[model samples]
Each structure stands twice: as C-alpha cells, then as structure tokens.
Target: MYAPQEDTELLAGALVEEPVPPGADVLDVGTGSGALAVTAARRGSRVTAVDVSWRAVCATRLNALRAGVPVRVRQGNLFDPVRGRSFDLILANPPYVPAPDGRGRPRGAARAWDAGGDGRLVLDRICREAPALLRPGGVVLLVQSALSGPEQTLGRLRTAGMKAAVTRRRRIAFGPVLRDREVWLRERGLLPAADNEEELVVVRAELPV
Candidate 1:
C-alpha cells in the first residue's frame, strides 16, 4: 500500500481550506493510506474511500480505526464502488508518473504512480468522471505532478463545464521513483536535464450548483 507522502499532505491541506458542511457526503478515490478520508470524517462529513488495491483498502480501514474516525472503505477502480452516488466532495491522489511504456496495467506498489507515457492515465479519467459523481456545487480536489500536465487537467475539467483552477503548488526534490525514472523522463522531454525538483499541484474543480 502507498503511504501518505508530500502529495497526500498537499491534498489534505487543500481539503482543510474547503468548507465542508456537517454530514456532507465525501468520496476519496484511490485512497492509499485513508488519511484524506479520516480527515474528512473528523470534520463530521460522511466519508467513503475507494482503492483499486485490496491492501490499500485494508490500510485505509486500519488507519481510520487508529484515528478513531468512521470511514467506509471499498476496493474498486475509481468510481466503480460509488456508482449512482453523488458527493459534496471528492478527493484524489492518483498515479501520474510518466512511465517508460505506460501501456499495460501497473502492478504492486507501482500502481501508486505509474501512468501512461504522458502521465494522464488515471488523471484524465478522473477529470471525465468526477463531474458526474459530484453533487451540484460540490468539488473535487486532485493532486498531480507538474510533469503529468496540470494544465491539461485544468483544461479538461473546464471543458466538462466545471470551474477548475490550481489552488496550491510546491516544488520538491525527486523522490525515489522519480529519481529512478529521471533518465527516461529526460529522454522523453518530460523533465529538464538540469532540474532535480518537480512541482506538485492541487487542482480544484467545482460543479455548478
């Protein structure tokens, strides 16, 4: 299972700035460590978190338990587990690394960051589907790597008729995964040869009420 990292904390920090009504419905997609779900529940919102990995699902439940917050955890891809349900808030920190191949499905821990060649495998899908899963006036806050194309994400969400913008950004040195893929990323023109840091961004999109 993926542990909470910089992107996780960045997304959670942005979540704190959002005005969540008491008992508001919240969905956390790709909830790795259940941190976001637990945070939402602690704010008195009803939370449901979904992960494609069974291990992640178990981890979320365990973390929620330790945090003394109630979180409904489910194992499924993206929106499958919450079909027909609309929520006041949706949170996501999906895999957005630009993999060398980016064709086949990623396995094991790689699932936490491997995306297609352009790093939008899961990001694009979230943009397309999140709008439908959001209640009118609800918001979806997603964190992604700058290399994965945050502008593309913003444009996609805007095209979906939602108000979308980048709310927060941070630059951090390359982590293990990115470090390992640096050569490939540079060759693909996704990373600068001289740069060792990447910009992480929280893109927030709101549905019209």
Candidate 2:
C-alpha cells in the first residue's frame, strides 16, 4: 500500500481550511492509512472511511482507534460501500500517476499510482460518482498531481452542477514515483524536460443548497 505522501499532506491541509460543521456526516474515499479520516473524526464529524484494499481498510480502522475516534471503516471500491448514503462532506486522494503504456491496471504496489495514459482512470470515476454522494450544500475535496488535469476535473465537477475550483495548490519537487517516470511523462507531453517541480492541487466541488 502507498504511504502518506505529498498529495496526502496537501489534501489534509485543504481539509483544515474547509469549514466542516461539528457532527457532520463525512465520507472518506480511498482512505489509505486513515490519516485524513482520523483527523475528520477528531474534528467531530461522524466518519466513514473506505478503501478497496483490505490492508488499507484494516490500517484505517487501527489508526482511527489509536486516534481515539470512532470511524466506520469499510473495504470496497469508491462509493460502493456507502451506496444509498449521502454525506455532508467527502474527501479523496486517488491514484493518478500516468502509466507508461497499455498496461491494464498494474496488479501490484504500482496500482496505487499507475493510472492509465492521461491519468484519468480513477479521477474520472471520482468526478462522476462523488457528486451524487454529496448532500446539497455539501462539498467534495480531491487532491491530485497537476499532471492528471486539474482543470479537466474542475470542468467535470462543474458540469455535474457543482461549483468546482482548485482550492489549494502546492508545487514541490518530483517524488520518487514522478522522478522514475520523468522520461515517459516527458514523452507523453505531460511534463517538460528539466522541469523537476510538480504542482499538487486540491479540488473542491460544492453543491448548491
């Protein structure tokens, strides 16, 4: 399982900036390590965290317990475990690194980062499904490398009738994953040669009340 990294920290920072009402219903999608989920629960939101990996689900439950907060953890694909439920707030830090070639979803640890070409695999699905899970006046927060098209994410969420925008952005040196994929990323025109800095952006989409 992928550990908490730059994208995770960026999203967590955005969560701090968002105004979540006390005892709000919160859903955390792909809650790897449970960092964000625990924080939300600590802030008094009733939390449900979900991950596709059993390992991650287990980790989240353990972390929430250690944090002395109650978090309902589940194992399932994004949004599936919480079907028919609407949330006051939602958060995600999905895998979004662009894969090198036509390798249908890498089967190992790389599955946490190797998204299909254009890196829209999980991002697109999140944009499509998350809006429905949000209650009116509720917001969804997503963090991703700028390589995966934050503008496109904004467009997709806006099309779904939410006011969507990049709420937070951080430019940091490429991590090991990006450093390793630099050549292929350049070849795909996703990154420029000699450009070592990548921007991570937090997208916020809020439905009107």
Candidate 1 clashes: the total is 0
lDDT of 1 by residue, 77-126 (tens): 98999999999999999999999883587888899999988999999999
Q: How many residue pairs clash in each candidate?
A: 0, 0
Q: Which residue pairs in candidate 2 collide?
A: none
TM-score of structure candidate 2: 0.97
Model 2, 1-209: lDDT tens digits are 67999889999998987899999999999898999999899899999999888889899988888889999999998899999999999999898989877688777688688779988899999999998988999999999988999999999999999999988889998888888989889988999776789999999999999
Model 1: runs farther than 4 Å from truth? none
lDDT of each: 0.94, 0.91
Model 2 Cα shift for residue 15 (angstroms): 0.6
The per-residue C-alpha lDDT of model 2 at residue 75 equals: 92
lDDT of 2 at 37: 97
Q: What is the C-alpha RMSD of each candidate to the true structure, in Å?
A: 0.9, 0.9
